[model samples]
Target: MKAILAFAPLFARLKGAMLLTLLLSLVTLAAGIGLLGLSGWFLTAAALSTLGSVFNIFAPSAGVRGLSFIRILARYGEKLSGHDMTLRLLSDLRAWLFARLFPLVPLARRFGRGDLVSRLLADVEALDTLFLVALGPISTAVLAGAAMTVVLALLLPGAAVIYAVLFFSAVLLVPVGLVLASRRAGAEVVAAGAALRQAVLDGIDGHQDLVLFGARDAAVASSDTAARRLSAARRRLGRNAALAGAMVQILAGGALVGALLVGFVALEAQQIDGPLLAGLLLAIIASFEASAMLVRSATRLAGAAAAADRLQAIATSAPGIAEPAAALPVPPGGEIRLEAVRFGYDPAHPVIDALSLAIRSGECVAITGPSGAGKSTIAQLLLRLVDPDAGVVRLNGADLRDVAGAELRRRIALMTQDAPVFLDTVRANLRIGRDGADDAALWQVLEAVQLADFVKALPGQLDAIVGEAGRTLSAGQARRICLARTLLSEADVIVFDEPTGGLDFEAESAFLVELPALTRGRTAIVITHAVVPASFDRVLELRAGRIAERAHVPA
Candidate 1:
């Protein structure tokens, strides 16, 4: 409940629409009940007036017609307002969840790609039931029940008390009990659904690896087990909800019986006429129709609560990088310096210890080291993806922590070996680096990365679709496309983590030869295990998280 309440601000914005929905729902329920009660009373009165020959029929007949008309119109209005409010709420919720989750990409990925997808698409969607099923139905029941109770009290106080007691028991007590009974099963259903989705995704994504490793059977079995668990949990929750609905029906039936028994006594004592007695009995049955919604509402509330808890966990998790309270401006020059930086994935195994280095403005420097020598960590630190544990990283004497991350990233662009290639048009992918970049600017960057010819040969050229992760293109082509994207950025400093990793020796050498011209004005830092090219001004070797050797590369 607390997790769901976290979105109170979002709900507050839709309160007006929600209130209108509730009003229409109430009016719809009231009119429907009035129609039934009036019809029953009018029939009885007409029969009696035919025998007495002195009773008026015009007023009752007009009321029956008017209520029938209102019932249809109010029902239509209720559906319109309710659906409109729900759709708008769902749209806002998706956008809000995406905005909150986007910045926590590193942390989110730790939860597995399939798990994160389930949270984003499935878990977030489950919240729609929160309003449509739980809040709307439950609120309408309470308001309509109160109105019915007040109207009945005017005719017969005893019956009104009995109806109110039975109404609240079915609406509040029965639903509360059902929620408690199904809470654990509801949570299990949510977890099992997420697990099943993750298993399917894993099987699809890693089918090749599973086949190669002879683990395809194991993967299928795992997915089947998850599906079974999900089915079992859902069955249990359904059983509990069915039992609750049965109990609500019994309570509603009891209320109607009590109203009818009381109406008979009032008729015999002349406290109420036959027509009015018939109206009270019929209205009792009609009023309970709205209360019936609570039974279903209670069942769905448990699932919605579980979904809220899951979404809140990710939405509120602490970020890997903290934003500055008062951001400093980015420096004019891209002179990166690290002073005694220390970092580790865990305290027992440090990755970067007392690492100190500097790259002057507009100088191309290359850092070469064996695997796991903290070369890429330096790039991450420069880009402010993760802050150092103990020391300060500064850009032109301004501490990176003091500057806003977006501003810092704007000045320093990173192109990693496994840079993502989104399934979008070539133009769309490149424009990610510089939104609204002209075609000429895009072509220039593609030429610099040596991918212009390949793109031009494609059917759509600049508009060519790069399949998911650039699967449609060859490895070398995809890497170059990513490189072109990085080059399209207006950053003053560019860092490449193994820029030529995917290319053959000839292509690598060619790219290395063009590096100087590509990075002629901007400061460049290339982190790689490959041999350093003469295009760089200096080469530094890292060993055991410290700089072991430094050499000046001659022109």
Candidate 2:
């Protein structure tokens, strides 16, 4: 409940729309009760008048028609307003979550892709019940119950107390009991659902590997376990709801019987007439309709509460990196220097221990070393994705920590070893580097990467939809597509990690030889185990977390 209440500010934003929805709901309920009560009275009065006194038939008939139309129109308006407010609230939630998600990049390390998707999609959707099923419906039920109690007091005083006790119990106590009993089951449902989603995603992503290893049955068994857990949790929640509904029905019957017993006494003493007594009893029955709605909504309240806790955790958890209170601008030049830097995933075993290096602006440098020798870590340090532990990384003599992350990234772009090509058009993928980049600019980079001919031959040319992760393209073509994207960036410095991956030896050598000319006038750092061409300005090797200068490069 504390977690749910933390979103009060978001709820406050749509207060006006929420109030409108509530008003329409009340109007709809009132019209329904009034229509039922008036019909009962009109029919009874007509039957009684046939024995003696003259009762006008015209007025009651007109009122029944009028109330029916009013009920229809109000019900329509209520549904329209309720759905509109709920959708707007959902939009706000997605926007809010995404805004926080950006600073938490490298989310792959901290969160599983399948789990993150579940939070962003299923958890957010569960919140839709907060307004439509829980708050709005509950509020309408209480208000309608109170109004009906007041009507009974005026017309059938002897039965007023009897109706109030049972009706309020059905609306309030029964639903509260259901929520408390199902809380654990609701959480189980959410956890099981997430596990099921993760299982399915893993199976799909590793289908080929599973087949090769003859482990398909193991994967299927894992998914089936998650499915069975989800089914059991749902069954428990449903059982609780069914019991609560039965309790409400029992109370409704008691309220009707109690009201009838007292009404007969009032009639014998001449305190109420036959027609009015009939109308009051019918109105009491009609009001229980609101109680039924409340019980149904109560079943979902528990799930919504659990979903709120998950969302709140995301909203309040500390970001991977904190921004400075007053960020300084990145300096102009692209001179990068690492001063006695130290860092490691585990502090006891450092990957880069007191390493220092320098590269002047417009210099093209290549650093080559064995795997797991901190080569890729250097790229991450330049991009400020991770900070050094013992020393400072500076840009133009300014500490990287002092500059804003967004500004630092704009100045220094990185093409990681496993850079992905999104499922989008060729033009769209390149535009990620520089939005609004024209056709000429895109074509220029494609030609530089030697992928222009293949792209031009495609049916959609620039508009073609590349399959997921560029599956439709060959391995080398996909690699070059990512290369083209990095080249499109306007940063002063660019770092390429294994840029020649997937290409033939001849193509790799050619690209490496032409790398300096392609990245002219920029500070380029190429991290690779491939042969470094003589065209580069400097070549250094990293070993044991320290730098060693290489005496020669391949001609």
Candidate 3:
């Protein structure tokens, strides 16, 4: 499950016009150069043989222009087709990357800020080189080099032999060496860039905490270090690139000098005609420039691969829980049972272990424990966010894993203390629990949560645009709105984790008083550190990682 490159099959599946466009473009590029070389050879030969001849003058004039037109058409086709394919493929790559990422968020959020930031922005961007540019050029470079090698050998076997070696040196040898020299440096550079990206995310998210603690200056200093690290890595990698380029240039210059030396001797000895020597020499020079482009493309490959590796890592990580292929149908009752369950976010540190509990339909239970003593873990178990490492979680005797995902989640409504308020309208946030709810339906839930009056008094009422993370609302109001969202679900089972955490005495009182009505006929599990009034219900406490005790309400 940890092998990240498992998703390569998805990329290898792009079909239809995408592959065709890439092929057509590369063919056009190689063919255009070949035609241009032929035109030059023909024009030279005609003039040399027919000096002051009538047919020679007209043929060069008419035939050269016709060849020029054909070349321009191929060049145009190559550029357009290559560009079209790259753009479309870029879109497909981004979507696939995003889908791979979404399933990992709950697990990945456990990573440090630097790692997450880099994965989202820096790593994703690094892949631009692979999809948008290199794919086509790398293909064309190999194909064109092969065609040129054959033509040179046919023209003059000795000269072509020399050119073929140079082509291999430029296309393969030089680039491979450069990549080896720079590969580790390139990966380091990407890591540093991700660190810097994480620093930016932290600075923004912790802005209020930094201000309160008078640590703004310290935070900025940390960010500066991250930025410097990124810049230094880039500079070091750039040096490696410059060094590789220098080596390629030296090889290319020497090959061209060799061609000139060999070419002049052949002409002087009258082994090949002047026209044929000129044509072969020009072809060799053209191959050198193309190879230089190929080298630049190779250097970018290290950066691209570094990005792809991160994306692959996300695609292949294991999920916290795996659903079963089949299960017995769920019973009509919303009753749930946990038997000898043990679990942990980290194996070395168990959060809930050997915990056993049961809740009949229409029962309301309040779970209480010291902070970090697995109070929230019980609530999480009911929602099936994380399955117990050992033991069973069942709904009316049907194993949770066997039930369909949507069916399991739909009948249960949960509100966590750390739940983020989305950037949406007041109504929109409430509507998430019941998407097609009308105004009357929304008001009913608001009344149950004791927020009906406040919502009605708002200038925009249901249409009020809440700020990002519900910033425009006070803490208690935000919490109540979230509670209202839970109420609107009308689910068979409801689990509330510290729902009244931010509310004042007045708001808290109303919430506690009005909430029991909503839980009637539905199984409810409430997790809290605070004690509620002695109501007619069961109470459970957790210690270490297990359920410590269960008792009836003392009153």
Candidate 4:
């Protein structure tokens, strides 16, 4: 039920292979250890038995050679299985993260900058120790320590017990200390990255304004501050890494020192032969690697734990808009009406209050308003981009809340203020509203939007790459492509957030020819920042989140 334990089921998918590997390694380690103890006894016996060196060596030589062979096999098994388990856990983690992220981006964007990136990239990387470096080595170390203790007790009881106690303390201390050290760094890294992401976003979002105001220096300075914070966090994390290494060395040194003192006392008492004492010390040294690995794994796991926490929050986050299970049916004609609407993105920030308007099935309504007076919000509400806090948005007498979001969206095509051409071909961008639309359909919409000549002249024709965010195309050209997308939708309703923005004389003249064609036979709400089309059938003026004036004219 808890996140810490929740990862178990996902990781458990590879349990069989992991267990197989564990079994192989344990057997391998035990066999190798037995061989070491036996070889040590033989060496001592061979040395003591013969008066001359050559004859003494030959008697125990075969046993020592066979033991060495077993040790080699054990080492191979341990390395192989440990790595296999790590790979499995890594795959499970990556899959789990992606599944959580798919539906959460829209909600996560509202959470603020740097949070998601830290969780996804940095935190996920840290969590790798949950399995890779942690579980296997930790297990191996415990088993090896137990074996060493029993062997040590045979030679010297007090020394063996002390060694076991030191190991226990190191095991307990590793994960907790590493996590505490990394917690602040993980949080800081996320914060700094968020600042970095926001700075770039701000600059790109305001390219025109920044250029006009000559604020390049300010943008660069803000971006540099974000970069500096990121570097500082890295420096802090680097220190924690060094500390983790120091902890490992301390644990290893303690074990080695205890083993040496106890072996010396046993040799003096004649309680064990010389070869056996040497073998016990060597085995402890070999197995100390497990404890060292535990320390490293602990450090890595801390980062991952922080990341998983963020990702978990994102996956479970509820959406801003909730849709009903059963949708209310709207009439065939797509007449739209808003009634006594009070709405805003935030509870304290109602952008439109008590606003009401109605349009017939095929009439065009040009919504004109001062900036931030809710013209775009009206378009958003009608499209169900966001649901209203109070009041109703209706299509043909049916409430938007009762209509399935996907179904309602299908009946409408929106060209929004944030509309930018995708990094796709001209034909590809236009077909966004219409899947499986052929070349003929593409040409039809392009001609209507007065971009046919431009489309024809591009080297790749319809296949040309538009570049990132349609940078390859002029703003007016990009707008025309979006308008063309509306024609392909053939939806009952259309909302244009800003149709004539970023246009030149030639583009405006071209826009006039095709704009009406796109609006024909569609219930339309056109929001504009610039000139309102006088030819539209009706216009509503909004101020302070309410309709201030309405005028009707013949087309």
* lDDT against the true structure, each candidate: 0.84, 0.87, 0.72, 0.73
TM-score, structure 3 vs. true:
0.73
RMSD of 3: 5.8
Give me candidate 4's TM-score against the actual structure. Answer: 0.73
Q: For model 3, how does the per-residue alpha-carbon lDDT over 1-555 read when each residue is reduced to its tens digit?
A: 122144345446655544665566555555456455556676678767755554456665565566566657756765675566556656766787677665554644455677876776666655643543555566666777787778766756666666677777777777677667767767788887777777888899999999999999998998899889878877877787677677767776776677677778877888778777766666666666667676667767777777777777676676555666774568787798999988888866788877888888887777888899988777777777777788998888888878876787788888887666788777899999999999999988888776789878888988878888879888778888888888788588889898878777776655655556667888888887655545526777877876755665442
The prediction achieving the highest TM-score against the true structure is 2
Model 2, residue 445: distance off in Å is 6.2
RMSD of each: 4.4, 3.8, 5.8, 5.8
lDDT of 4 by residue, 1-555 (tens): 145565777767878867776666666666665666666566665667655655556545766677667667766876687677666666778888877665453444465544555565555665554654656656766787788788778766767887787766566566467768787785677668767887887788887898899998899899899999988987887788777768767876887788778778878888776777767766666666556666666655655565566666766777556778887776787799899999877768899988888889887777777899988788878877677888888898899889887788788888875677888887788778798899998988788777899989998989988888778888887877778887789689988887777787666555644565568788877786545455667778889998854655432
Best by lDDT: 2
Model 4's lDDT to the true fold? Answer: 0.73
Reference-based lDDT, residue 178, model 2: 91
Cα RMSD for candidate 2? 3.8
Q: After superposition, how far is residue 388 of candidate 1 from its true place, in Å?
A: 3.2
Clashing pairs in 4: 114-194, 126-304, 127-304
Check candidate 3 and list the clashing pairs: 353-545
In candidate 1, the residue pairs with backbone N, CA or C atoms under 3 Å apart (3 or more residues apart, or in different chains) clash, namely none
Better lDDT candidate (1, 2): 2
Runs in model 2 lying further than 4 Å from the true structure: 44-57, 214-218, 325-329, 348-355, 366-375, 417-489, 497-515, 527-555
Residues 1-555, model 1: lDDT tens digits: 687898778878889888887888888888888988988888887787766556767887899889888888877887888788778878888888878776775653368766777777777767854776788888888888898899889997778888999998988899999888988998898888888888998899999999999999999999999999999998998899899888889989998888888888888898999988888788888888877888778878888788888888877877767899999886698898999999887756889899988889999888888899999889888888778888899898999999987888789999888888999999999998899799999999998888888889999899999999999988778877887888888899999988888778777776666776788888989887666667778888988999855765543
